[model samples]
Target: MRYIAIDVGSTFLKAGQLDVQNLAITHMESIRMPEPLPNENPLRKEWNAIQLLELMKGLIDRQLASCPGCKGIWITTQMHGFIITDEYGVADTPYISWQDERGLEYADKLGTSYFSALMDRVGEKAWRRTGLWEKPGVAAVGLFHMLQQADLGLEIKRERQGKACAASMNDIQTLDSKRLCTLGGYLIQSLTGSHVCHITNAAPTGLVDVRAGKWDKDIVSAVGCQALQFPRIVVGIDSVGHYHSRWGGVPVYPDIGDHQASVLGSLADAKNEAIVNMGTAGWISRVSDAYRIGEWELRPYFEGRYLPTITKLPGGRNMAVLVRFIADVGQSIYGITLTEDTLWERLLAEADSFSQKFLAGERQAGKGQLHVHVGFYGGQTGTDSGAIDCINGDNLQVGGLFAAAMEEIAAIYERNLYVLATAGEAIRRITFSGGVMMKNAFLRDAIAKAVGIEAVMAPERDEVFLGLLRLALVSEGLYASVEETREVLLQKLHANNKGA
Candidate 1:
């Protein structure tokens, strides 16, 4: 029999059909991200729910038709977003991108508690927390929605351009919630017709009390949003019930965070291991049975909580973030309009050019001064006041393929591994995936060499989809536990002889 796994990612949603008994993938495909429509608002139009959901329905129908007798549908999506629905089923918001920076100015408004400490506690490197309100770009709306209206009410706020800060009047480049749509709640809604969120997204809300695994009233109040609009909370895999009671009673299973799903596919070991998934961005992560109330040492470094939970970044987010800026500059210079146009081509060309140039540079490769400290995230904390520390990224370049770029990615990975090794409990084997691993052979080789361990790469691993599939396993009664699934998966895969 076949099972369906849907990976809900930022750029596109991907799906794959897996043979349940054999754990083999039959077919997989990802659709293009549709452009936004002329809607009530430009941002709202970008997430055009009606258009996007229709696309999802069409894809879902086609995939299921191909995989006759498919057991269930499991989905994984970006965390920290939720849709406000009335008692009936309806969408109140679109997908809220964690990359949205609406929450950045929040820390600035908190007055005297010294948001720095709390900011540190929130784990800045998480990527979700890297925006103006001190929250990541993707989750700004959710924070505003979930926070008490009385706290961030219109009367008490300040505005820059047209938008206002959550607390008091202030000026900052905040992300509009409408621009970034919803996340977990909608994914669940689309599947089982239930409006619930998984632990992963809830943990990042700045609303959900991570320790209790429930929404905290104080946090809710502090956010200046509402609690009533949110959905019910559910653990990973507990069957979202039968899918809509339509199409012969197929079941719907939902998993946790986007990275968590990939973690499942990487080795199925739900234990301790730092997952370094280098896609549009690069990240490292490890799971703990119990969530620490607050762990600053654990933050990724650069962009705040803007990254996946598995991400580790002592090098910070600035370095990686800049890669894109550099890419933009290069593309402009090359007259290439589309920056994210191609995967392998862009990566190979840039890295190769940079390597050639750096090897041939004449910037006086002498001593102390020659030692380069590439800061995309943490280093940005001081270097230029505004920088990202994590260096391994797809986009960057103040301009051109500065030969230091390759070393930038490598150096970033090396530093983050140090933090990853220290933050969580005992370390298990490291599993790598994402766009970065899929494209960059040099980065992979350097990673294996730097990590100094037996590293495995699945030339066929579509982690985004596989991660979602693993969640379906939990949601469906087909498996007893994720741990069991992990054991089976790890045993089956032929580990590569180090990095290929």
Candidate 2:
């Protein structure tokens, strides 16, 4: 059977048809996700929840029309964010992007009291219960929603061209009886008319009892959110309902998060392997059999598995921002427009020379003099901040900046491994995926070197879709679980290769 897999990503909504028997993508299409409102706060990245849901439906329709044999539908989406829905299943608030930073500002303002008291009481309890920390980005909206209900004068402010704009807080009070779901949950509700979310998305929200796959009532009580406001939790194999599409009604499964789905899609060894997905925001994940909370997040993966993930900043997009800055600076300084390729080549050459010099002990990487700290979310914190930290772009040429960023990313990989090792999980191998390393072999080599392991490139570029396809198959009773489906598909692929 064939299945339609939709990935509701941060920047794009990707849909594809997967041939289950052959384990290949037959067709694929990508649609750009709607941009944040210009009038919204410059720091805030958000989208109209209802509008995006409609666009997703349109894309699903296109996929169904193109793939005549589509039998099932499965979806994956960006993990973090809050989508508030009223009793009529209409969105009551804009979807808050995980990149939004207003929560950090709130945390900073609350200072000692926030971390010591509120975070310890509310956040820690939730973390212990759900295996999810109150990460500034992940749980910010949920916390804000709760705080606003208390009438604590907490305001969500937006600025448009320096003019102050305010998001309506009137919706906060009414949410007591309303429903709140993630982007995936809301979209699934629109598609299958099911007010439910899968464990992959639910566990990371600091709102669910991850081990039990249900909302933690204690947390809801502590956070002052109504237990009924949250959507019911379901696993990947659970079929919520049927989506009435161009191909008629198909069994639709609960939507999962893109990160976990990517891990599944990459076909990483659940026991002994790690996955590094490099993109606009990069992350390293290692799957474990059971819940094990630690400094890093223990996220719920498919089939009751847990993933301990360490996030990385300075991903491809961050590197691109620095590259653009260097190009712009070079053009203004010398009346010569330097292309990204040219700059990258020059930077690589210089970085190689720098590496040789360090090996020979002829020079040392300066400490405290320059440190390019990528943001918490792996995207660019500022245009020139990353480049500026590595070199003085005005006075010193852009030689080691790119190298510094690459090294920092590798260091982050190593650091995360160290944390896992400290937690008593020793990973044996790593499988890497992402568009950034599709061309840049140097960065891949650097990561391999830093992690002290050979970074294996995932064979499938459409691993995310493959993961969703597995979910669809499992839902259809073709496989017992995602892991079993992956193993059986691998066996088929191996046998086919042998025959060929």
Candidate 3:
């Protein structure tokens, strides 16, 4: 059997054909995500909902054309953003992305930010129920911002007028509805004609009672969003409906969160292993058999499992900051333009050389090294500032800078492991995935050495799609359980390697 796996990622929209019998991806394709729409408030990151839907459909059509015998479609997407839609799933507003920070803006006479006001009204219990950390970009925060604008009545009018003016030039819609869902849910509704989302995606919205496996009525009432329509929650294996395309009607599963999907795809042993994924952002997650709350964000995992995760750690995006800085200096001072790829090549080489020297006792740790904190973006503790300290004559260069940054990133992971430990998670090994870990061997080594554990790379390159494929298998009844499926697939992989 075959299934089509789609990942509506922040950076790219990816699709692949999963050959279930062989346990391998036969074909794959991707395109860059649509650029964010221009807004008067630069902090507001929005996308053309209809445009994104059309682009995703086009990508699926291309995939279906390549694999005509595909049995079903499974999707996973970037978490924590949403679009308002009507009963029929037609978008009423632009897609508010996770990068949107409108909630940070002051909202009232008391000068309380929208996020603060929402959290204040809802109280701390909402966070415990949702198993999510309070963030400005969460769907609840965005919805509260919209509700406040509508209640105040002036900003919504201005926004409506602006959208009306732009509607003639572009096909954008104005904000006019109360129903909201993630981009993945919107796609599933458009495809299968069902309005639903998986718990993995809904839990991040700060409205779901993750422990109860349903929407929290108290949170909905407290947020003053009782009029809003929320998607019905489903499990990973639940089929929403069928998508009737020209090729054929295929079973469409409910959309899941990309973070959960990537962890699932990592194929790490959930009992004693943890996963460290670094993409645009970074997170370290470990599976728990029961619901447990701690300093970390807890998310619903497949098979009634819960993942205690430390999210929003600096990763590839943070490294990009340093790369851009070096490139900017090169262009401005040396009158030469340097590409990011060239800069990364040089940086990785230098970092590797430094690691070799340190291991050989030629270079001493902390003697002349820079103390770099790569938290260019704020972390979970609300620490928005990052610093580089102990800078002296010996480590001010680009190579040493990147090396120090890598060390700091690794150290952050090491420090945060204690949070999981406090929550009673005993991690014996770490499975690493994401572009940063895949490309930078020195970073991987640094993290392994720091964590004092055996480290292994994720078996597959496209962990999101691989995860979706696993879900598809279970959903189709090919396997009795996720654990059984993993064991069988691992056995197949082992046998393939032995035969080779």
Candidate 4:
């Protein structure tokens, strides 16, 4: 079977068609976001779904024109999602950006503290033993909620067994009237008629119960979204649903977090491999079959819109801005613009030389001698347009390349790494993708050296789109399981790269 995958992102929507028989993407397309208002304030409504869908539809339609035989689809989006819907399944709101911390202010209203405390008791590791839910992010949110609710219900239920057990995690149900799913689920249902989700995307929202594979008790109480509203839960490899409507009802599967998708698409292999993808933002992730988490990870572990995980840290995109401050050392001398490909080639050459000197143990290390921003992203300036709003990635362009500001960014990135290593120690290897890395090969090499690991490039150019396409194909059940699919993929990639 052939499949079409739709990846609804913050500023863009991507779709790709894959030939399941060969397991390769045949066509790819993207739609850029419409510009925001003049005042930069969001309009009465951030976006209309119909318009967004039409945008998506147009992209998919164009691809379908080439691959008429496609029969399955997989859709995935940013981790925490929301879209308003009408009686006819039309959405009122476009899916919000996974990067949108607009919900950050609602943290208190959502009872985030309770979950924060709960992590202290439980953990962020994936206990993937059968019958025990072990998803990491948003999926953990829902599962944890179910366990909490079950505990609460068990407390409320006066059964002898229940009384003997003291409310534990095992007595949860999927029948909750007030189950809530991220806005993405609603969008999936509207498009395909199946309310389904996957572990990766679901885990990021603090919504899934990692151990129980259900909603966290506190989440439903706080978010008040009905479980019935949830799309059916499917393994990342299961058939999501048929595309059905205009694009043809191809079966669809959901993907996990966008970063997770990027991780998988990067071809990051087991326990030690990881990567730092610098694009609109940067993310460093390593893969593990078993989850590693601790009290330290627990305390600072943020209960994001999804389930709790240990590797949680400050922002990434903001960190890139910090690099830019110091980047001008070579860039300015060469008259290179951040976005210019040719300019970057020259800048990278100089950065490589500068980085080598620093790496060769020639630079003195005194806290006061040189300082940069790595732990948090602010007081920095970079060329990225959204860098400022995302304080974690924003910078003020304090000094030219090699300037104090630039030094600060390197310092900050290093500091951030220390903090992350302290929490997500399980990351084994680092991989990288995205335009930023492409622009600054020196930075990529520098980051790899800092982590003491080799950074693997993504198999294809856009891991984001590949992940979505992978999800679409997986959800279609074109293959029996993700593991199997992965095996096939590995074989094919090996065959192709044999000479390399």
How do all models score by TM-score?
0.70, 0.84, 0.93, 0.65
lDDT (10s digit) by residue, model 3, range 108-159: 7537998888888888876688898888888888877876765565443212
lDDT tens digits, residues 1-500, model 4? Answer: 67666666666777877676776776777778764312242311234445555676666667777777767555556664444343345442233333332221213323663334344334433222111222222333333433455544533121121122233333324334323345456556655766656655554455555445565555444444444355455443556556665645555555455665665566555334545566665444444333444321221111121111223322335444545554675577876556645544554555455445542343454212323434343222222122222122212223223233234443334555554454434555666676666655556555666566556666777676665554544555565444445566767778878967
| lDDT scores of the candidates, listed in order | 0.51, 0.69, 0.80, 0.48
**Predicted candidate 2, C-alpha RMSD:** 4.8
Q: Rank order by TM-score, top first?
A: 3, 2, 1, 4
- Candidate 1 residue 231 Cα shift, in angstroms, is 1.7
Worst 10 residues of 3 by lDDT: 164-173
Q: State the TM-score for model 2.
A: 0.84
lDDT accuracy of residue 257 in candidate 1:
68
lDDT per residue, candidate 1, 163-226, as tens digits? 3234421211122221112464565576666667666566555555544456656544444443
Regions more than 4 Å wrong, model 4: 36-47, 92-94, 102-183, 224-230, 246-248, 295-316, 319-343, 356-370, 374-428, 465-480, 497-500
- Clashing pairs for model 3 are none
Counting only residues 3 or more apart in sequence or on different chains, how many pairs clash (N, Cα, C under 3 Å) in candidate 1?
Answer: 79
- List candidate 2 segments past 4 Å from native: 39-42, 106-120, 139-168, 330-399, 422-425, 491-500
Weakest 10 consecutive residues, lDDT, candidate 1? Answer: 297-306
Candidate 4's displacement at residue 175, Å, is 17
C-alpha RMSD of candidate 4: 11.2
Please name the candidate that would achieve the greatest lDDT relative to the true structure.
Answer: 3
Model 3 local distance difference test score: 0.80
